[model samples]
Target: MNNSVWNVTSNSNLDTLALSHSTVDFASHGSTAGTFATLNVENLSGNSTFIMRADVVGEGNGV
Candidate 1:
């Protein structure tokens, strides 16, 4: 028999939030028109589903 204890946690909560003003000028200068991502699931077994999502917040009207 083996007795072990481990603790894992995450602290990623934002305390305050503020959006950019309307007059602020911001643009996506990089090449962000078409983008794609891939994942290798060879080791994943049993009942599993791949979930992909994106949380995008466009700052001002230029983004």
Candidate 2:
């Protein structure tokens, strides 16, 4: 689990911002078989442009 915050103050606009996650795993069986992941962002001013991108890579071992 992780938590992060960013504060920016500039006359010009931001070109790009990136977030990444690698090798997230889930239990094979039992009560922990399923998991939940979430990402939350708050813009106090509520007046900004945002572009989000996600990539998921899966590898199964016949579980």
**Best candidate, lDDT:** 2
lDDT of 1 by residue, 1-63 (tens): 012211112222333322222121112222354333433323333232223334356746755
Name the regions of candidate 1 deviating beyond 4 angstroms: 1-33, 51-63
Top TM-score: which candidate number? 1
Off by over 4 Å in 2: 1-43, 56-63
TM for every model, in the order presented, reads: 0.21, 0.18
Residues forming the 10-long window of minimal summed lDDT in candidate 1: 1-10
Superposition error at 35 for model 2 (Å)? 22
